[model samples]
Target chain A: MKEKRLISRRRAIFTGLTSAGALLLSGCLKKAPPTYGSILRLGDDLTYLAQRGLLSQRALVMEYQQTDITSFPVTDIGDPANPASTKAYSKEYEALLKTDFKDWALTIEGAVAKPGKYTLDQLQKLGERTQITRHSCEEGWSAIAEWTGVPLAALLKDAGVLASARYVSFYGFDKYAESIDMLDALHPQTILAHRMNGESIPARNGAPLRLRVETQVGYKSVKYVQRIVVAEQFVDPAQDIQAGWSWYNGI
Target chain B: MSASQTTHSETFRHKGWVKSAHFVITFAFLALLVSGYVILMSHPRLYWGKAGNDLTPALFELPISKNYHHGGWAKAIPFKNLKGSQVSAARTFDIFNENGWGRSTHFLAAWFLIITGLLYLLAGIFSGHFRRDLAPGRGEFSLKMLWRDLVAHFRKQSSAPGKYGLLQKVTYLSVIFFLFPVVILTGFAMSPAIAANYPFLLIIFFGHQSARTIHFFAAVLLLLFLLVHVVMVIRTGFKRNLWAITFGK
Candidate 1:
């Protein structure tokens, strides 16, 4: 009788395990996002889904006081004395820098009803929003800063974003580009920051204009803004996935 | 002879679900440790408070890589409100930065660990595994019993063939009830997206960098536990324990 009971219990355990495995496999098949070559990317999908589920659509990140702002890092900007040290530094950027970006203009064209170009003065006139929020990096560091900018939604509205647009892409003069979905595109906290800590953004920190995506990692906040493109689908920004960074990176 | 045989036959065997969870947790933990180590190799300094970088003073620095104090500290410059803060763009040496796969694997293995751990917790509660096997009885908490176990451990004296000693029970209980949960919570507290939605985690951990520092220490403790656990298993009839866990016999 004892042997029989053991057998039944073992059978039950196997049955339960098999069912659980089947359930997980089916769930992955149905709901898994883009795997980006490796099966481990499914974990990224799980994280994305879990975070989205937990966060309300318009949930705002914790804001800090001006005194709470910390010393923010300037990554990928390289030494100003040696502009060749960084990947983002270019002859064009150097030339623009020489005159304090007097001739630089931001172009908004793709999938917009009104394609146009705007100078710094014009972009600043659209609207102003100042927020002091923590900037979390993928490298396990975080710093709080007060950023002043025009809401991305305001810019999109002014540019007359088309109904078919699903993603908004930001291209930087530094050759870096990133795209965000509609949810983040319209988020009140998302802005094209023109100033940092009450001063015009330093060249080391994306001068003239930079994208502030408060909902995501710091990398999502592209710097040195040069153009904006509204698109139907996300354009993966140059080997970002192949290089093993998550495209969404909401955290 | 017959009585002894009966006692031997009735030796404790781990339950099926317990064995299953243990198997999954072992692999998941190994994955977490390796991937976590790889990720740590990229940036090995631990700090406290809301933010930290190479420029900030570290609470602890691991000597595993060249990333620690690479080329000394950058000179402090006047930042926002603070007078003379270190600039963060002064790294002189490139450390091991191939941590993309590490990050991916770490998250994946973390999911497995969390799911299996939660299931184990529920099963332990529902099946009375925690009560019967892990949790020490009221009488077992006596100092004499603990001292005896400690002395025996020092002398390399093994306990009864399959019984848990008072020391074993306490250690296992602490690991399950405290260490694992702390590690998982600290891990979640480091995520910006999670913190955005649940600021309570940040408050509980004190800050983002604090959470990271705590996570590192907890992981180190867990690794130490794993080392001791393996050594104990090997010393106390490795084949027998392995067979019992694998076959539930």
Candidate 2:
């Protein structure tokens, strides 16, 4: 009788393990974003799903007082005017730089009813929102800076994002590109920041325009944004998955 | 011997749940250690306060260097120092270049450890396993007994065939109640969304960098515990201990 009970318990454990294996296999069978190594794939999925499920769509990250702003380190400077590194420099960006970015306009296109270019003056006309938020980097550092920009939601509303729109992609003058989900794109704190600490953003700090994805790690907030593209899906031929950075790094 | 009279010398007395939990935690801890070490090697430094980077001064630094080849020791790569007072050398190891894999494995194993630990705790509590087997008995509470146990452990005196000593009980309890929670909480404090959503976590750890520092030390403590645990198992009786843990025979 004891042996029978033990066998039954073992069978129960086996059944449970088999079902879990089946569930994990099913997830891998789907057309999901490229996952990490086999050992980590399941946990990655769990974390992504849990964060999305737990947090409200409009949940705001903690905002701090202006006085709390600290020394935000300047990084990733792209000098388009420098002829020494022509590969990194864009002629169009150099021209705009000569004119103090007056001629620079951010072209918003893809999955939108009204696709057009909007100047810094035009974006400012949409109204500005200043926020003192911490920029948390994936490399393990954080700093507080007050950002002044137009709420991305207002721009999306004006452009009339179509029902098919799901992800928002940003192209930068420095040949850098990144994308964020529509959920983050429509976030109240998500904006196209033009000024930092009450002044026009310096060259080292994405002079013309930049993105502030408050909900994500600092790399998600691409600087020197030249164009905005709304897409139905995330297509990263650029090897974000192959490199080890998760596409949905909400934390 | 009567069937009702429990034999203290029986090595296989532990239930199936204890055996299962032990195996799970062992594998999970091994996986965590390997992947965590790889991740640490990527940025072999610790810091304090809210922020740290290549620019900021590090609190501590490890001597490990990155290498592109598969050769050991001799093939290590060196850092290229930049001509700035504010910056540290751009140093990296390229042997695995799998920080993505390392991070993924680390988190996966962490979840496994957490789930198994919770199950063990719950089962231990409800089934009286903790009280019966782990909690120090009346005789063990005496100062003489406690001192004897410590001396025995240090002197390599073999314990009774199956039962744990007072020192073992206290160490096990500390690992379960204190070290485990510290590592988990510090890991959570490093997450940006979680930290930002609950700013109090930042205050509690003093800052994210401080949390990372604590996490590193706690992991080291865990490693030390694991080393002593394995040594004790071997010392008591390698074959018996191994068989008891694996098959509960």
Candidate 3:
């Protein structure tokens, strides 16, 4: 009788465990995206949450030797011939470009004690850093490039970004816009790059200035940056989000 | 014999945990394969170096073409433009687009497969299931027996009941221990965050793109394994095999 009771108990436990496993798996399989048009975006959400919670805020991306630098691919969104190209070269950008970007200045504003525009020469006078790092693109390519620029943290500190600022948004001359969390904004490697491969950044490569966000995907590093906005909350760039890109593309 | 008597006849069955794992793995593998294929369709070309794109040379290119009408080889592969007439243009079979859903579901299924695989491995090892059932015994490892097994398959003669043949055992062991692990590791090596943190993975796998190529081939090998597995199951008593796996009868 005891043996029989024990066998039945074991069966009960097995059945319970199996049901639990099934339930967990079924939860993931639920609401299968119908016709691929009704795709779930929750996967992106889960990844963002997990990475944000688990990964170290201060962790640095790997850097390489100067010899490791390779020919970085130029994704000229402004080029009409490129697939899914964008006309980022607005009229304002054209006017700025016509003069070799001599009149161009990057404006810092919002949630700051001091808000003003700083010229390329003024920005260059600030502390700078040089590093060789791989830029991994979402389109399945990567290249190492040496960048020299003013550390964004030093610039932000000088501008006196308020304690209330939670996000730092970037506006580019190409009309490409993006924003980053405070943690990313303050990361040591984050910078406003002016030089590529020990020379002035070329016009095609976002000349005068570009943002180098070491930890994020290449697209997050907005090129030809014109403005920076500090905010208390994140403002999603809806156009890019609708184009089917994860808002947080650290991967 | 009566139907009732035949239904009650003695049959070989694996343990409960083994049966459950098999059932779950079948679904997970299928999900992974479908989603993986969908994601691959978006970027069909494979490259060897760290960088590649439309302009860069590719190691291998799929029989696919692109246009504005369809996102990929889906709907129809673009043949040529005929005087700006959509209908006049000829297009072959291609079912591209849905990259959004493809990427999302691919990652989801990948996570599911990884979790299920880990649980299955732990359970299998702890319960002595793999050693008892999967590991080949003394005589089973010999080349002569292996040739005999291969010959028997070609001769259309089914092996003895209630036992895995040498080829089946070896294939399963290698896939479980080597192929799946390599696929998972290579997949991680392709991730920017992971790759940036561990550049050594790039060195080990040659480059990021090479890791991606390795992942693709490993998945293809798994597909081959699945094809052979399904064939063997059908050839050897299909109903009996299904019953054993499902009910452990």
Candidate 4:
């Protein structure tokens, strides 16, 4: 009798759990209708397909030759409110762009063995590579911009990215500021682009320098980069949280 | 409910094709509740922007159009929001994929919920769940009755009006009929695809964003109502209520 009673109790608990689970799920199901989820979510799933491989390299990012791209114009800074503005961008910021960024330089500082400032020519001479990648935004807009620049891995290799560096914080001339995991920083597709669309990047487009992160949201791309600090930890651990952005915006 | 010309012990029964409709509506409404919520979570900071912007990618699959792919051969695809200022990004992680599918899913499910809800509403007029289960008798509306219900519910002292009392009817009437329509209407209002297809709805909804915000709250209200419904059922007797819904024993 005790065994029978226990079985009945277990069944009751199981049914109750199912019912509650069903209730929660059903509540979400009756929303804007199911077709919206079915139709739209499918198209935007290329990243999911790539990451999860709904279909392998059929989802491969298109590649382009550096010769096919235009130089990106400097329009904005990476961080509009970043307190480190003075230390981030000096007069060289304007002078570089004024000179068509022909003399602009990018410095990899903080926690790297070979912390050095790289001039534009120096960066290009490091071996330029181009990739035709899609930039996906958080706001539901997308664009295809061919980006040409030194591969992030190559740059990190030059600076000797520290083994303990967990994140690479990017400071840009645009109002935007962001950081990425070292893993993303070393992604083969991730680059510091100086050109776009077969011409110099427009000033409005984060010209002179921007981080092209193919795996994350547009907000994290950090246009108009001024400096990069590879660190063992986040400058702001809750930066993404405070910004209401996802820390893991992996495609 | 007061004993009147109506049968006092009249048990609720599923009428017409309501059994099938119930299952379909239940599943569809259930799905809407879930996937719709996933989309909502994507843009928890709500504003009138592109629906694609507001959704997630890994879980949902909304269809999106890019690069002026004209119709006929224009292949619709599910894509993630990619990272960039360019108009055709390859992919960014959203709660779901976008080819305009999440909204479509939400709309289709909402349409089903609304249509079936209307049928249930009409049916309620004849079936008496509204009358028997929800409508509070003359005494039910009084402040005293309200206090008594609160006390009875908490203290477990209230009498089960045999069929339903004032609380049950008012809750059901507001939730099943009133709230469902409002949510569905609000959802339609927020959808440009729907509004463009059905221009007349624009007049009713005023604008897309307005409908969106209102629709979100309406869902919340329905959820609240559902909570009350469950609480009351459990309070009254889970098995008895379950019997009424399933077997009406």
Q: How much is B144 displaced in model 2, in angstroms?
A: 6.9
Estimate TM-scores for all models. Answer: 0.87, 0.80, 0.77, 0.42
Q: Please give the lDDT score at residue A28 for candidate 2.
A: 46
**Candidate number achieving the greatest DockQ relative to the actual structure:** 1
Q: After superposition, how far is residue B109 of candidate 1 from its true place, in Å?
A: 0.5
Residues forming the 10-long window of minimal summed lDDT in candidate 1 chain B: B1-10
Give the range where candidate 3 chain A is weakest over 10 consecutive residues by summed lDDT: A31-40
TM-score of chain B of each: 0.89, 0.81, 0.80, 0.64
Model 2 off-target regions past 4 Å? A1-42, A65-88, B1-9, B66-98, B138-148
lDDT of 4 by residue, A165-190 (tens): 76788876543567776656776778
Residue B212 miss distance in model 1 (angstroms): 0.5
| Candidate with the larger lDDT of 1 and 3 | 1
Candidate 3 clash pair list: B73-B94, B73-B95, B74-B94, B74-B95, B74-B96, B75-B94
TM-score of candidate 4 versus the correct structure, residues matched by position: 0.42
**lDDT per residue (tens digit) for residues B1-249 in model 2:** 222222335664668899999999999999988987877776666878766654456798765545212222212211122122222121222343455677767777888998899999999999999899889987677778878889977766655656777888888988988999998888877776666567777778877678888989999999999999987776655677788878855
- Model 3 bad stretches (over 4 Å): A1-39, A65-67, A79-87, A239-242, B1-24, B67-98, B246-249
Q: In model 1, which regions exceed 4 Å deviation?
A: A1-33, A77-86, B1-11, B72-77, B80-93
Give lDDT tens digits, candidate 3, residues B8-63: 24455688877877777788788778877766665677878665544345788765
Error of 4 at B190 (Å): 20
> Model 1 chain A, poorest ten-residue lDDT window?
A75-84
Full-model lDDT for every candidate? 0.79, 0.74, 0.71, 0.55
Cα error of candidate 4 at position B88, Å: 13
